[model samples]
Target: MFNIPASNIAHIIQLAVAPVFLLAGIGGILNVVATRLARVVDRVRSLERDLPEADPDQLEVGMRELAILDRRMGVCHWSIALSTVAALLICLVVMILFITDLVALNFAIPVSLLFIAAMVSLTLGLSLFLFEVTIATRFVRVDEQYIMRRRLL
Candidate 1:
């Protein structure tokens, strides 16, 4: 009810603060990973659109790059998905913190579990992001022209 004592209210707010900040950090991570996923999808779509009538050599090279892009996209998708789940779990933990204090029940175990789950999900998401980055590196086109200019000088 609305009869929460001022000190209890202050303590509850204090307990909630850390989780709220964690939620904010998770939100930022989710935003970045989601943007990366969207870019991957966009690249795949562009490649698919152009693959149909490409010249023979272009088709071969394009298909190879497309395959790599597909793998990269899969990892990106997983990263985004896991980050989303982590964000959800973090939100749940924050809610549970409030509810436990309000109802006079022990929240230690459940809140810990939820926080751990969120961390695991976030870790996996970041790992996928790392894997995708390495995959992306495989397809990056370096500026040979720039290097050649240095050689010529």
Candidate 2:
């Protein structure tokens, strides 16, 4: 018969908190990238609309920058998506391990499993958050501003 102490439970809770930090960090980074991309897109669109008759050389430069930004954004999105999936899988595995450990009445196993789960979950959440906050939201805002600016001009 294995009796788990309250302190152990507390420890687990603490471990669980690790994910929040990871998520926040990842979100921050993603947000920055997204914002920059959005700005670039906006600039390209603005140039296209407001300066339709501008010199071909200037137009070409804007188009090139837009293309590069688009490619980068796409790569970032896919990378984040893949990482999130992997993290989820790791979390799932940890859950399974915990369950198995519990069934066996192996305190050590469950504790280890929980620890792993917490770590994996934290990583996944952080990565997803980063991508959403840094890249995705910024991109949208930039695009919106660009469109509005072009319209007004």
Candidate 3:
């Protein structure tokens, strides 16, 4: 029931603006990953500095484990970053298509349906990414458990 003209260029402008939202979302995810990695690196450095020098072999083993943990976290961080970028790109494409359809039909029933679908897809993707980040933070708890066990022995 929208009265916007089929030939209106406002839809094109809206489509162009939609990518900014996608970029912002991607940037947010990257920022979270970067912050998390920095904290992990800082914790590892602290462990290295604080560890006692009494047992060289034990220290070496601890350092090796820390290195492995760092590598694994780095891989995960990169993987999340890449997926965020990819999802953002996909959302941008979908937004463009939704806007194109809206313009062609002047916001008719089919265009409204497409718009709803696009919004739902974007929301679901964002939610899943958030869940992944939450789960990833549990890795810190695992590291803490290892530290506790080491202290016990």
Where model 3 places Cα greater than 4 Å from the true spot, the runs are: 1-9, 51-61, 80-153
Clashing residue pairs in candidate 1 are: none
- Poorly placed runs, candidate 1 (over 4 Å): 150-153
Clashing pairs in model 3? Answer: none
Q: Residue 148's C-alpha lDDT in candidate 3?
A: 92
lDDT of 2: 0.56
Better of 1 and 2 by TM-score: 1
The sequence of per-residue lDDT tens digits that candidate 1 reaches over residues 25-123 is: 877877787787788789879989998999999999888988888888788889888988988998898788888888889989989999999999999
Candidate of highest lDDT = 1
| Model 2 Cα lDDT, one tens digit per residue, 91-123 | 554455445444545555555565566466546
Candidate number with the higher lDDT (1 or 2): 1
| Ranking of all predicted structures according to TM-score, beginning with the best and ending with the worst | 1, 2, 3
Backbone clashes under 3 angstroms, per model: 0, 16, 0
Task: Kindly report the root-mean-square deviation of model 2 from the true structure over all alpha carbons.
Answer: 9.1
Please rank every candidate by lDDT, starting with the best.
Answer: 1, 3, 2
Best by TM-score: 1
User: How far in Å is the alpha carbon of 10 misplaced in model 3?
Assistant: 2.8
